[model samples]
Structure formats: C-alpha cells, structure tokens
Target chain A: MAKKLLTTLTLMASMTAGAAFAGGHIEGAIKARQGQMQLYAHYLGILGGMARGNADYDAAAAQAAADNLLAVASLNAGSLWPQGSDMDSAEGTRAKAAIWENFPDVGAKSMALTSAAANMATAAGTDLDALRAAMGDLGGTCGACHKAYRGR
Target chain B: MAKKLLTTLTLMASMTAGAAFAGGHIEGAIKARQGQMQLYAHYLGILGGMARGNADYDAAAAQAAADNLLAVASLNAGSLWPQGSDMDSAEGTRAKAAIWENFPDVGAKSMALTSAAANMATAAGTDLDALRAAMGDLGGTCGACHKAYRGR
Candidate 1:
C-alpha cells in the first residue's frame, strides 16, 4: 500500500511540473509578442513624420514601413492574452484584465489600425496628402486601445 | 528738390512696410510651427501607447511612427523664431528669445531626434529589442525640446 501511495504522489508531482512548464511557455510567448508590438508602434511615428514632412519622399522608406505594419496586422492575439494572464507579469505590462474581458473589441481595434496603416501605405507613394490624412485615423486606434485596455 | 523729396518719402514708406511684413511673416511662421510641433508631441503619446502595447508586433507600424517624426525634426524654426519675436505673441508658446538666440542647439536637437528615429526604424526590423531600448532616448528628445523651447 505504501508503494502504491508513493507512485500516486510521484504522478501528481509530474503533472504539476508539466502544468507549470506549459504556463511558462504561454507567458513567455505573450511577453515576446508584446515586446514586438511596442517596437512596431515606435516605428509608426517615424512613418507619420516622414509623410507629413515629405521628408526624403522616397518610395523605399514608405514601402518598408508599410511592410512592417503588414506583419503586425497578421498577429493573432486572441489566443495570446487569455483570461487571468494579466496578473503581475514580467513585462511590467499594465495590459489590464479588460484586454481579455473585452477581447472582441480589442481584436477589432487592432484590425482597424492595421487596415488604416495598410491604406496609408498605399497612398504613400502616389498621394502623400491622403496618407497624412489617414495617419490621424491610425492614431485614433492607438488611443482607443490605451483607453480601454492599458492600465496606468 | 520736390522730386528728390518724393523719392525719399517713397523709399522711407517702402522700408517701413517691408519691416512690418517681415516681422509679420516671422511671427506667423513661429506660431504655425509651434502648433505643429505641439501636435507632434501629442501624437507621440499615441505612438508610445502603441509601442508599449506592442499593438500588433508590426514592423510597419513601428516604422510608420518613426518616419512620421521627421516633420518635427525638419522644421527649421531659426528664421521663423528670430530673437525677441515673442514680444507680442499670445499662443502660450513660451518660445524664449533664446530659441533664435541659440538656434544651433535647437537645430542640433531636432536633427538628433531625426537621426535617432531613422536608426530606430532600421533597428526595429532587424533587432526589435534594441529598438525598444532606444525609445527612451527618442522620448528624451521631445522632453528636451519642450523644456528648452516650449512654454506651459
């Protein structure tokens, strides 16, 4: 009976350890994805500035910025930010519970920003003035997410 | 004598009008540039939010934000904000006499932000972690400008 009890205990321990590993993997992926997202926004500012200033007015730079945004657009955050995932994480990320709580809105907004950015790039080479106008809409998407999801 | 007097009067009147026009143009440009610069900062907050959120892990969004910053950088305020030009303006633009008084530093800082942003865009695609680190430096540029040139 003692041997059987010991065997049961060992199995329980292994299951617990496996669960922890799985949890860590998810968390790590979320952190890495979040980091990438933040960097993406930083570059967007550069694109907006260039378009508004007519700086360099080069197609290459415009295309490069657009390509980067398209990559971001493809990210599927629905599975990434699951419920209870916002609890004290390493990224010092204030991404609140509202992210999961209101997941649909968050996803929709992200998609909207992506669409706006894509449209902006399309206008970058041929019609800079239109691109400039679209930038405001892109900014609005950022603001909406911060208002609804990010914590102080 | 009458003809000479008329020529002298005409020249004096033209000189006075020229001075007034020059002053008006400088003042108007300063105000306009100041407004644009302030908007750039406001947009920075939006971009920062997206960056911090890693909104879409998007390289294009990041580049777009970085590129858009050139508007604030290329704004050559030297001519627009001549020394002592803020005597009567009331846009709350606390642009000190030192803006024109110390134009080179102002130009340098603006250029610095531009360069930093360009470097950031390049880094963003190849080395996102480095791009994340550089964001603080970019923000410093904005704060430095506000502290030195912008008014409350």
Candidate 2:
C-alpha cells in the first residue's frame, strides 16, 4: 500500500511538472503556429498563382490546394496561442498583443478565413474563372487578419 | 494572327520562367517541408503526452490531435521535396540525400506514417488504452523514416 501511494505521488508530481512546462514553453507553441501559417502560405500560393495566371490552372492541383487550405483553416488552433506569447513577449513571431486583447474579434476574423476557404474549396476545382472569383474573398480575409493582428 | 502569336509567345516565356523558378528556388520548398515536420511534431507531442501519462487523457483533445496528424500525414507533399533540397544541399534542413536517392522507399515509409496516423485517429478518441496502443505504431513509423531518410 505504501509503495502504491508513493508511485501515485510521483505520477502526480510529474503531471504537475508537465503542466508547468506546457504553460511556460510558449516557444514551441509559437513555432508550431508559425509552421501552421507556413502551410497556409504554401496552399495559398498555389491557388494564387493559378488565379493570377502565373501558372496554368490544373483542376486537380487547384482542388488539392483549396482542400488543404480549408483543412488547416478549420483547425481549433486555440491551443497554439497561450497568453503572454504575443509579439511583445515572444521573439520570432509577428502575432500581436491585440490577438489576446480582442479575443472574440480575433476568433471571428479567423472564422471568416475558414468560411472563405470553404467557398474557395467548393469553387477551385470547378474552373479558372470560378477560382478567380473565390480568390478575392479568401485573400481579403487573410489581409484583414494580418492587418489587425500581425505585427509588421 | 500575328498579335495572337506574339501573345502566345509571351505566355510561353512566362510559363517557362515559372517552371525554372520552381525547379531552382528550392529554399521555399525546404522551409515549407520543415514547417510540415514541425506540425507533425506538434500534433504528435499532444498525443505522446497523454500516452505517456504525463497529461490527463482528454478524449476531445486526443481526437483533435490525432485527426490533425492524419490530415497532415495524408497530404500530397511531393512538391515539397524538390530534388535539390536535401541536407547536403540545403542549409536549414535535416533531410538526407538518401531521400532523393530512394524515392520509392521514402514514399513507402511516409505511407506507413499515414497509415499509422489513420489508425491513431480512429483509436485515440475511444479510450486511453486504445490511444496507448495506437501510439506505438505511430511512433515506430516516425522512427523508421527518421532512421533511414533524415540526417543527423
């Protein structure tokens, strides 16, 4: 019984330590969120090229990129942004303090991107003109969020 | 006819330039793929903590992490592996030349990860025991690929 109790105590101690580590290590969260943004950029770049006629519009590739964009955009990424990990506190990140200050607004703005991405995904595989039309809405969401929440 | 032919020539030149840029400017590919790896690590960290009993097993969080892992693992990421972006050629990547040399093998290895992640996604939300069982397979796939294709 004593041994079992000791083991339980150790596990509890380790769990507490883990929680502390998770709370403090915002660097990992910062890097992970930035990586997620890179994915957004990559998929967006593909669709943007096709929209601008800089690259030929392949239906399959367009669909794939748009689908990927929607998948990442739809993620519940709240875990990636803990308090005190904004531009003022963290290095190597452009996420502004306004993100935490204006939480619901930031969330709503992100939802706009998700909605735009859903529309883009539906239209991208259809045709170039359809993709072109959807691109405007999608791009606008990205720009709005960056302008409001990302530090230059 | 003459003006149309000139327009065609201009488009062709731009297309060729775009292809050349895609083939040569491998820095973006390196960064993008590395970012992808970062995502895999992040999602895996979430599940790993629960599997190791370092974090309490929340069914929802586990499911979300597993689903995200499967999503990224299933991406058609061939474009991210442009030939010249290996460890020896790229500055900020640990992808080894073996990856290029053994393309089919690398592809097969990646498929294993996808397969494992799919199973993990199914099992993770079920229970802690199920998540623990799935984690071993998922972690093994990661280790196998890193052992063969990732550089030190």
Candidate 3:
C-alpha cells in the first residue's frame, strides 16, 4: 500500500514536470493524455484515501468520484494516442512504444479498466467495506496496465 | 466561433505550461483543479467540433462526450480549491481569489455548469440541432464563470 502511494505520488510529480518537456509536434496529444491520466489518478486518490482510512468516507464524495472515473474511462480518447506519441517519441510522456505495437491488446487492457471502474462506481458509495473490495479490483487493473504499457 | 476556438487553443496551451509553474506548496491542489478544467475542455472540444461540422457527428461519440462533461461537472471538487490556492496564491492557476471570497456564489456558478452539462448530456446524442442548442447554454455558463472568477 505504501509502495502504491509512493508510485502515485511519483506519477503525479512526473506529470507536473511533463509540461516542461512537451514534444513540439504532438504536444497537444501528450497533454491531453496526461490530463486524462491525471483525472484518473485524482478520482482514485480520493477513493484510495477513504479505503485506507486516510480520510473519512463521505458517500456522496465517493460516489461522485467513482462516477467521474467511469465517465473518464468511457471517453473516446483514441485521438490522444496518435502513433509516434510514445515516450521514445515524446519528451514528457511515459507511454511506451509497446502500447502502439500491442494494438488490440492495449485496447483490451483499457476495457478492463472500464469494467473495473464500472464496478467501483456501483460499490464506492455503498459502504466502506464494499469500497475497499472494489478498490482492490480497480487498483489491480491500474497496476496491471502500468506494468505492461507504461515506461519509467 | 473562431474566437472561441482560439481561446480554447490558448487555454490548452496555458494548461500545458501550468505544470511547469508549480506553486511549491499547493501544487497538488492546483494540478487537480487544472486537470478538471482540461477534462471539461476535452469533452467540450468534441461536442463543439460536431456542432460546428468540424467533425462528423456520431451519436455514440456525442453522448459519451456529453456524459463525460456532466460527470466532470458533477465532481465533488471542494478539496481542489483550498483556501490560498487561487491564482493570487498559486502559480499556473487562473482561479481568482474572488472565487474563494464569493462563498456560495462560486458554488452556485459551479452548479450552473452542472445543470448545463446535464442538459447537454441529454441533447448531445439526439440530433445536431439539439446538440447545438444545448451547447449555447453550456458555453454561456462557462463564459459567465470565467468572466466572473477566472483571471487572465
């Protein structure tokens, strides 16, 4: 859990620095994707805090965050991942070339996130225990994709 | 409309540079709010394109973007606007201290965005004309808030 928090913090820090290193050509795309990721992290950060007892659980807040997560997950974001916008090609992104190479595999991974977010959207405001359970699935999906597609 | 697009392009550019101007203390709060604004822009950009015939109007795409806009607007974002996190106190943020001073006024302005977004969510997928009509309301709400609380 500590490691996960650390990773989240690290990701946020890098995201902040990313704007400074924007690639000249596809800078818009990079910023758009990074912004999406930041929103995901923002909502997840809220739920994670409640699940871990770092913050008191407010059902309305939890539900809103979960819904935001699902909405973002459902966005038609294909335009934000144009070819040649990977980390190797872009200055500030951590998207790996493997993502472009993976094609439908990356698409499937994104679907998993959507599915997990949908479940959490249902579970988040119900109760603390339910939120904790759902967070496991959501967090696992996030970690799985980062392991496969994200670069350091 | 050209002027609006230009303003949006300028906003995106500023948001991209925002991360580079971290306010040191409230950077996390600043980034979170900026991310929310970017998400709003992203969805609005999609709907605006379709409305203006800049992009072919797909019902599914329009609905998804509108839903995302509503979800983002509905976020419980009170925490992202801590006292002393406005433009006067934080770098990279256009949020004016007037927002903090306005109390429920700022809250009401935000609620206006939510209502407009909800209407857009219902209209966006119905037809181009419906989408265009709703966009006027949504865009007006955005402009009103920016004029009142956002700084250049």
Candidate 4:
C-alpha cells in the first residue's frame, strides 16, 4: 500500500510540473507578442500625424518620429513565436501550425517590411514626397506576410 | 519717370505675393509633417504601454492603432510639396528634392506598412501572436523607407 501511494504522488507531481512549464511558455510568448504589437501601433500613429498636418512640423518632432520608426523596424518576428505555443483554445488567437511549419517565409517578409520602413524614415525629413511613396511599399510588405502567415 | 515708377510698384507687389505664396506652402508642409510625427509618437507610446503591461492587451487599443496607421499610410508625399519649396529656405522642412525623384518607390512602401498594420489590427482579437508577428513586418517596412529617405 505504501509503494502504491508513493507512485501516485510522483505521478501527480510530474503532471503539475508539466503544466507549470507549459503555462510559463505561453505567458512569455504573450508578453513578447504584446511588445511587438505596441511598437507597430506606435509607428503607424507617427506616420499618420505627418500625413494629416495636425502636428506642427519641427526638427524635434521629425527626429523623434524617425527614431521611433527605426526602433520598430528593428524587431524580428520569428523571435516572438515559440513552438507549440498556439494554445489552440486561447481567446484572440487564430495562429495555425503553419507559423512554425513555414516559418522561414514569414521571417523573410517581416525583414522586408522592416527594411522598407527604415528607408521611409530616412527620407522623411529630407524628401517628404519620397517618404510618402516609400510608405506605400512598406505597407505592401506587411500585407504579404499577413496574407500567408496570419490566420485572420 | 511715370513708366519706371509703375514698373517699380508692380515689381514690389509681385515680390510680396511671391513671398506670401511661399510662406503658405511652407506652413502647409510643416503642419502636415507635424501631424504625422505626432501620430507616430502616439502609437509608440501605446506600444510601449502594451509591452510594459501598462495597457490591457485587447481589441480596442489594437484596432485604434491599426486605424491610425492606415490613415497615415494614405497620405500622398508628392502633393505635400509645393512648387519652389526647398530645404534650405523652408521653415519646418527637412524634406529634400529626392522625394520627388523617388516618389513611386516611397509611396509603395508606405502602403505596404499600412496594409500590414491593418491586418494586425483585424487579427488582434483572433490571434494576438499572429498579429504581433505581422506588426513586426510592418515595423520593418517603416525602417526601409527611413534608411533611404530621411536625413538628419
């Protein structure tokens, strides 16, 4: 009877440990993904302000916007995802297995978008017209990735 | 002598008119760029908040950011430039002539970034991770434009 009790306890402990590990992984992914999304929103806002003429054009504002955009451009998408992180049942999640299965393409498209954004910021103050044009391409790159990898 | 005086007055009038036109153009561009810059800053702040867990990861914030970005992406850089506007003379201007020369490419990039941002927002609630990943690409597109066009 003692031997059987000990076996049961060991099994329970292992199950708990496994669950904790999985929970930690999902939480971490959530945290990283949140960071990425925030940055994306931030840059877009800056670009919108510039287009609308609502903000006063000044060196300080221009420099700040450019810098922020560059920072956003630096984020790498692949680093944000972990294997088996789909948590298939999580609310606000439509991630499919394909993210990990065809990760390379997703990564490539992400890089492409970053490169385009960087170029736009660089030209923003110096060449408003060119910046406008570049902004479009940058948007396109983002679309390409979403069309393939994003579930919704 | 009367002919000469009339000529002088006419010249003065024309000069004043020219200055006024130029000033208006400069002011318009400045206003537009300022608005865009502020939008970018706003988004960055949001992103930062999301990353630090200061803001809830929800559809509302995500959608707002995405919508703002799309609005920014739609701005036409070429239309912002007025004839005779120059970097050396214009106040609140860092835009160089290169913008016009490279207008097509710049527009394309901006659109790419916008589309990606929109996609991310659309997917925010359904798949935060996927949305995050797409945001990464969107950021990259912003950078690409900055690298080539923006100048200190």
- The candidate that wins on TM-score is 2
For every candidate, how close is chain A to the native chain A in TM-score? 0.72, 0.84, 0.82, 0.70
Every candidate's DockQ is 0.02, 0.23, 0.20, 0.02
Candidate 2, residue B35: how far the Cα is off, in Å: 1.3
Docking class of 4: incorrect
Q: Candidate 4 on A1-152: residue-level lDDT in tens? A: 23323332333243234332234334444454544454454454455455455444333334445555655455323223545555463444556657555544555665677677777677666644555666777678867866776676
**Alpha-carbon RMSD to native, per candidate:** 18.0, 10.8, 11.0, 20.7
In candidate 4, residue B76 scores what lDDT?
37
Per-residue lDDT of candidate 3, residues B17-57 (tens digit): 44322243256657777777877876788788789887677
Q: Which stretches of candidate 1 lie over 4 Å from their true place?
A: A1-22, A87-91, B1-152
lDDT of 2 by residue, B76-95 (tens): 65556666677897788888
Clashes of 4: 87
Error of 3 at A97 (Å): 3.4
Name the docking class for model 1: incorrect
lDDT of 1 by residue, A43-111 (tens): 454466566673444444445455555544443343334334564543546777666555446556776
- Top candidate by DockQ: 2
Q: lDDT of model 2 at residue A97? A: 85
Q: Estimate, for each residue in B1-152, the C-alpha lDDT of model 1 and write its tens digit.
A: 23323433443243234432244344444454454454355334334545576343445434444544543344333323433455344344476655544545665666667666666656554545655776788788878877887655
Model 4 Cα lDDT, one tens digit per residue, B22-120: 444455545555455545544544443454455555454455455545544443333234444446556556656565455456556656666666675
Top candidate (lDDT): 2
